[model samples]
Target chain A: MDILTISLVISAIHLGVPIILPMLGGLVSERSGVMNIGLEGMMLGGALAAVAVTFITGNPWLGLLGAIVSGLLSGLILAILTVTLRGNQVVASTAINLIGAGITAALVPIIWGVDGTSPSVPKIPSMTIPGLSDLPVVGPLFSSLTAMDYGTFVLAIVVWWVLFRTDAGLRIRAVGESAESADAAGIAVVRTRFIAVMTSGAFAALGGAYLSIVTLDVFQASMTQGRGYLALAALVFGKWRVWPALAACIVFGLADAFALRSQIVGIGIPHELLLALPYVLALVALATFVGRTSAPAGVGKPFVRA
Target chain B: MTSTQSPPRRSRLDNELRAQLAVPSRLSAGGRGGTGFGTFLASLGGTSRSVTAKIVSFAVTIAVALIAALPIVYLSGSNAQVALQALIGGSWGSPQAVAETFVQTIPLLITGLAVALAFHGGIFNIGVEGQLIIGALAAGIVGATQHLPGSLLLLASLASGMIAGALWALIPALLKAYRGVHEVVTTIMMNYIAINISTFAVTTGGPFAAKTQPSATEKVPLDAQLPVITPGTRLHAGLFIAIAVIVILMWVLYRTPAGFRLRLMGANPQAAAATGISLPRTMITAMLGSGAIAGLAGAVQVLGVYGRYFDGFSPGYGYSAIAVALLGALSPVGIAAAALFFGTLDAGAVQLQAVAGISREMVSVVSGLVVAFVAAQPAIFRLLHHLQRTVLAGRTARRAAAPVLPPPINGDNDLISAGLDNKEVL
Candidate 1:
């Protein structure tokens, strides 16, 4: 194919990876009977943590670790509120989102002595595959892939396998489908949910770190934007499965890439309208196909011990 | 826990579930033999036990939020005492400060009510921010272009705004009611779409863009602007409108048949459906009503404050409304109070920054803390209960064996159950 096609494909994958991480995170948490609308917040927390740690340590790998730790903490907060306290998952998640936004925005000035955007920090370098770099057309794409991008791809497979193949996966699905029955069957519902949610947080934070350290190397307040919500839409579009969700993320990423490139491509549509393409598409997709897919039966409900 | 009941008599099970869920005896668990007062407060739609508990919880929530900010402030190299002083002085120290606080309160009060209404009906209308934007855009376009008399133009502008907001909400409402799509996701999507649409309308070369200000529309006609209530302060007649809306909403929520249907539908969809209520219709109406109120908030901001629609005019007032509504326990009076408190925080932020060298984003942290505390109310209640039990037990051995009270009202159960029921509809 031509350079334009190859570049578009590469852009889509790069854009898709951020969303895929969160979607996978959400998938794990939801599969274990927890509803995490706070993925956006967790992702934001991760982004900030990554940036702050990298700024202090001058190491992108350490920044990635910081993001994961931040995400896990966010997940723990959600788990405590929703699981132990039996609070409304959605409300707790909303609170998490607000706190994520507020804390990140609040700390920006404190850390960098600046507001809105942080100073640029060191970013993760892209990896070059020796054999793939020699390919004719798509070599550039392979050469441009970062470690995080490859990690995300592998992570997706691990998530899918853990969710569907292993004994732990079965327990999660069982709890999600019927927490009461799962408890009766000797599974620890609350523990399973807590772990799932924390795992979700770590994954989501990794996604946020990708934006800061891997992609931009600078953190902006609310920079995750609505990618967290878009990931939710993608999850719904994918019917709460692994492969389909990943595909859905790719579709959204493609839409995002097109919107970005369309200005240069001189599409007749206004740039403002172009920016709205992904959300519009999400709305359409949700309205049309959401009726067919079923969420885990016990999702959203607090599992109160009898 | 009650799942073992026979399926043949589902209504009875629903009744029991409603009784257990609706009456928050646990809120009054701190007081021995306080079930009567708890039931009375619950009947009056209050989320806490007595007025005392409500006040105490409110104070604690604020205090905790402030204390939580202390460490952050210290870490930021700002003096906590100075920050506190500035926050107070800016929000309530002088008449001018009070007026400014009210300025912030107006939109929050309106949007908080909009959010509370949807929450009461078991719908999470997260798109209020988007609805407000669309409303403001409509009001701006109409107020600027209309050729009618002053009063007529103002009315038309406000009406157009409400219509725009309702129309915007219609998509999510229909999708939620008919397709079982969750409004949380759909409304959020609408918010992004609204932001984009507004940006397109006001940006340079767009339809409503001002020649001098590319990111904002032309000012509305003088006649269309809200009349100032105070001579020097920016306070306007929007305060009165906000109050009037609150009174009307309270009546609608507590005294009307439609309101009863809404509450019933929220409390238990099965029971509501059994009582001949149309679930989808009620959901659609509640969502539309929420959107209209949210729209009015935007219009009021345009006419009363800015006098024109500007890009990014709202600093997430819609999202903040959720915290306000929850903190207010979804009650109109409570929401008004909560909005006033949040308004104080917002108004004080500027002074906090000027005097204490702190960032205005500090207010967001406080608000976030408040919401987090509110979300964990059950745990707070339990902690209070445990403390009370220990103290009471120490005072008298006889009271030590008293059984645990029932759980506090899970305010979000209606939302979860409503979502579940909606999915089962199609």
Candidate 2:
């Protein structure tokens, strides 16, 4: 294949990394009967926490840890509101996003005493498996893959296994399908839901950390830039399954990568119009195919035990 | 211990489930078994109980919001007392402050009502932000021209804005009403598209780019500008228009048959469909109406405040409108109060930054906390009901032990039977 083609493929995978992580997070949460519309908020929290920690501690790994913890806390808030308090899931999720936006905006100035963005921080180094790195045409992509890219691929398989192959998966599916029946079966429905949502937080935060520590290495306001919503559209496009959702993320990522390259390569299209491609595609996909896609029965419904 | 502990918990769970289960005795649960005052309140209007409930919910939400900001105040190392005082005094201190708050409130009130209307009809029109942008662009383009007379110019500008907003909103409305797509996702997409188009339009070398500003459209003609209400403050004629719109909305919602259909469709779609109401038609109309209102907000902002279209003119008015609608309990009167409150915070932010050493972002946190608290109203109600029942349990213990209950449950059963019998008409 041509060098340009190989380069395009590499950029697409790299772009897909952030989206794929969040899509997987959304999948786990939705599959367990909670609609995690707060993926965006969790990612924002994670991104800020990750970058802020790396800036303070000078340790990228510790930054990742901070991202995960903050993301989990954000999800826990969503879980408590939607599950325990029976708040409207959509409203609660929107609140989470606003909170994330607000806190980050306030903290940026507080921490850096500057405006709009943070100073650059430590970033994760790319690694390549020895044999894979030696391939002819695809070698560059493989050799340049960050730890995040490999972890995303491995975690996708792990999530699929845990969701489809394990007994715990059965309980989750059972509760999501019919909470009353799950409760009748002694499945501890609320507990399972809490775990699912928190796990979702962990994955989504990893995606945020990937954006900050691996891709950008700096924290900026609104840095996620609607990727969380695109991840949601992917979950819908992928019919809420792990592998298909990841594939959808790749398609979206390709669009993003193409948009980026098109601007650099002097494509005739207007830059603003080019930036709008993923959102437009998401709308088209949703309008055309969302009806055919089935969601979990208990998704978005607060399960009240009688 | 287990017996006493478990029973209260179980009873509380039952109380929580009662409303969701559509229990026949729901009204009495709110009214405390129909004391004379409870019955009077229940009979005053179909929604009177809900009105009271909304008031209580909003009060609690505000209290929670104030408390929620304390941690931030501590983190910022500012005096909590001074910060709180500044927040209140800055928003409402002087005549100038009040006028500035109204300046912010005018556009917000219109958008908030726009959102509340769509939500009332079970449509989540999250594209208000996008619609507003397109509306503002239309208004700006029209207002910049000098082809028409004074009144005509103003009318044309505002009409163009409304038309543009409706057209922009129509895409998601059509998809949602006919294609069974979720409006939330579709509208979010539209917002990005609107932002892109608006940005492109105002950028250098773009169609509407100002020769002077380079990044904004030319200023609107003087004739098309909304008249100022105060000499020095930013207050304008848009406040009167917003008030007029609110009155009209209230009249339409309560006095017109169309409004009843909208509310009925929202509350129970199955009943609405069975009664021959077309879901698609109602949804489309609601969306269009919502779009027009949102469009007016944009036009008002441009004509009254900016006099031109600039890139990123809105500070997420559309997103903030959702919280406004919720905090206001989706009522016109409630929305006015809520908008004024938010307007105060928005206008006061500048002063707040100067005096209290707090960021304007605190208002966003406070608004978000209000939404969180308001959305949890049902849980609060459940807990309140549990407490009320527990307090009354001892006095009515022997009477409650009897199988037959008093008038409230029996009256509710009768009412439920009547409702079920004529469910189709309802």
Candidate 3:
């Protein structure tokens, strides 16, 4: 293939990382019977935390850690509201989104003494595969892959294995399918859901970190920019499975990459229209596949013990 | 019960439980004419008590929100007292400040009502933001180009806005009603699409772009603008329109059979469906109604405040409207009050920043906290109930002697019973 084709393919993989991570996160949470629409908020929180920590400590790894920690905290809040308090999942998630946006926007100025965008922070360096670097056209693509890009693929496999293969995974799917049956089977429903949701937060935060630390090297207010929602769309598109979801994310990523490059490619379409491509695709996907792809039966319903 | 039967069966059980708990007293009163007036008075008393409880709930939510914001305020290195003073003084300090606050209140109030209306019908219309944008674009285009008489032009612009908004909402409404697609995701996606469409419309060389201005439409004609009702303030005729909408909405929701059907659908979809109410029809109507109100909010903004549609003119009024609707407990009067409070906070943000060295986003934090608290209100009520059981032990006799209150119309009991039936089904 030509350089342009190879580069486009590589860029699609890179752009897909953020969406892949959060889609996996949402997949896990939903599988355990909790709908997490707050992925957007968690991603934003993680992005801000990554930027702030990298700026403060001058270490990209520490920044990634900060992002994970912030995500876990957000997850904890969600678990408390949806699990313990039995609140409306949608309303609670909306609050989480608001808090995430508000707190991040408010703290940005205090931390960096700036509005909107934070200063550039230390970035995680990309690693080249030794043998792959020596190959022909496709080598450059593998050569420039970041830790996150590889981790995303590896994590998807791991999540799939854990969710489908393990005893714990059985418990999670059981709880999600029917919380009462799972409870009767002696699985700790609340605890499983809590852990799944928190895990989702951590994964989603990593996605946010990929944006700030791995890709951009800086944080901007509301940087996630509905990528989290796209992740959700991808999750639905994938029908809540691992590999299918990964493919869906890559497709979305390809659309995003194409949109970004369309202006430079001098496509006749307006840039705004190009930018709207992924969302429009998501809408179509939702419209086409909604009832066909069943969500977890117990999702979005707060568990209240009799 | 089998897995496939869970939702419908559970909802039926919920209705049965509600009927058992709430119908007996009313039925007893109906059977006894001599005691009917006394029961009516008792029901009235119960309503007043519930109202008091609702007020307490709102107060608790605000209190929790302020407390949650305290840490953020301190971390930002701002004095709490100074922030408080700035917040109050800026929003209500002068006649001008009050006017500005009212101006802010207009869109929020209208959008809040829109959200509340949809939410009341079990629709989560998160796309209000997008609907408002489309409404503003339509209103802006008409107001700028139309050459009709003054009143006619204004009416035309507003009507165009409502039409655009309802049309924008039509896709989601149909998808939801027919395909059972969740409106939350679809509506949010629509929001992005709307934003892109609006940006395209007003871009440098796009259709609605002004000759001189960049990324904005031409100035709206004076004939289409909402006249300022107060001579010394920015308060426009839109305020009266908003009030009229509210009054009309309240009447529709409480006094009309159509409203009763809508409420029944929201509170108990299965039951409503069983009663031969067209679920899809009501869902479509509710969403369209909501979108229209959201559009009217946008039209008012353009006609009263901006005089034209500017790209990215809204500072998240639609998103904040969710909080306003919830905080107001979804009542028309309550929504107005909540909008006023939010309007004050929005208007105060500038002064808070200038005087207290705090970011205006602090308002968002407070609003988020308020929403969180509202979402967790059941927990709060549970806690309050526990405290009352323990602390007000001596009042148990009086409570027992009191008449039984009607079942809560908000569907919380439905959720509880639904949860209970899950076990039985399993």
Candidate 4:
């Protein structure tokens, strides 16, 4: 029981990293009323960039940073079109999503001379806190995690503080609510939104890094799969609140972990149904409960200057 | 917070782009088409802006799209060139390639037209993809399993496909009419339903499963083939079907009482009702028409391309068709050309991957670029407006001096401007 319990917690944490980073990343973009349908693409770019950089430079931290940079770059494009250029967010983001899938797959074999997959790298090492290593379940859970994992929880708190408490947060809120009003108040509404979306790129990049460097340990074509989208759903499920999104993400991660575990343990649950449970839950949550959990007012539609 | 791209922060992207957009005259910047015909062509030229603004915005949007697409291109590596060659070779290097592209695009053209008609009518039908899938399933089951004469089998299969698509659309149409639920969410949800249902039927060997793939449906009866029009190519008689559908669509849109009713309902549902058009009937018919055409697209693909139903046979034609329809500027002739262009890219993707050492996905990036470029039509108009006026002014100057060698084909905006004058105010 203890061993199973310990593994469950570890697995939950493992799944949680990919979920949380994207969740927080999505929170920032949607917080500013820019519907980032490109989260999937961002994660894909980050995963490929992380693996490519880590393989090239013998430094995993630099690899993580590269992923963040790639995400930021991609996010910049999406923001320019949707925010500044005032293009259709859904179509633009969907294009980005498709483009991300294609470009990452296209460049992988060229850059590293590998076939649509990255060269192997030593994974970002797991850091177990000293002396605390022998502390039973708590030790196993807390101490023996990658730096990425530790950073995520810390980042979560920081994101919560920045999003809810800061003046910048107030600006983002105002930009989302009434771009006209925000501009009237001299809030640099476009600039604040531009910042929010671009910063969102870094978070999404970290989410991608967590997948390639920490979780999967290598990049492959179409990596990050649908988790980025699932993370987006979790953000909505959590009602766009940071801590609640994290908690909702943990639940989703647990569900995913349970399904993966069930497959490993020779459980005979039907593959289709097992594969579908999480998505079904997400769709249901989106359709039934998401409306109750309101989005920023003035979402999706463009906010032209008065 | 916005970090500039590395090394040099503000270096301009290297591509020189001209803003290419059409503006119908007598319009508020980005809103609907102009209400008059006289200045329609004039407005099509748009207002003049500084060349610097025009070039930079064009460069910025394209650069942005390219950067967004880089991750996928990054993954393709060596196979890209090979894929590109194969895709181009397959799509347009030969007469067969050209014909095949047209053949493949025919259904997409019809379906895209279907979507455009509905969009113009104001019913958002994101469910076209699902409807297409369902239509394919229906056609497969009817065409493959039934042993009838060629003409009957083909007709029945096509009809079945249309019914399947229309029936699938009814769910959302009804929901929107009565429940106040947004069709966007339901249509997107229905995609999963269509995918899962098709996959399940194929995998489980329920009537339509192919004997060879086991996961795919059996081949359609030989008699059910959509006959080839061009002898030496993959081009099929479906081109006629598509053109016929377009004619029908044009008539229903511009020349019929029902089309007017659908347009009324679409333009303003509340106002449409005040004008005495039945709300439920018009809304449902518009959706059903849209669904049936999309269904025909799927059914045609199955009969014309693989001759059998496979898992994911549609390859998201429904989604791509939106670009096709919009690119065609929501006209039948326009959509046909746009669909052909998309078809060439899609068909050429394999060659591009195989020969150009470019990833097969570059086609997607290219298409996505075109769609984004097209969607920002309003922005493009402003940047090009100055150049257009200069050309028009120069044309007028030349007309006064000599009989023009070739009368300048009046530009697109001028035509649109003239077109705006004919219609009563919205």
Q: Among the candidates, what TM-score does chain A have in each?
A: 0.98, 0.97, 0.98, 0.95
Cα lDDT for residue A174, candidate 3? 95
- Worst lDDT run of 10 residues, candidate 2 chain A, spans A289-298
Compared with the true structure, what per-residue lDDT tens digits does model 3 show for residues B348-420? Answer: 9989889887898987888888888776765655565455545455465557745233233333343332322
Clashing pairs in 1: none
- Stretches off by above 4 angstroms in model 2 are B1-46, B50-53, B398-426
Per-residue CA lDDT of model 3 for A176-210, tens digit only, reads 88788899989999999999999999999899989
Candidate 2 residue pairs in clash (backbone atoms < 3 Å):
none
Flag regions of model 1 displaced more than 4 Å: B1-48, B383-426
Among incorrect, acceptable, medium and high, the docking class of model 4 is incorrect
What TM-score between 0 and 1 does chain B of candidate 4 receive?
Answer: 0.72
User: Can you rank all candidates by DockQ, best first?
Assistant: 3, 2, 1, 4
Interface RMSD of 1: 6.5
User: How large an RMSD does model 1 have?
Assistant: 7.2
Supply DockQ values for each candidate. Answer: 0.48, 0.50, 0.54, 0.23
DockQ value of candidate 2: 0.50
RMSD of each: 7.2, 7.7, 7.8, 10.2
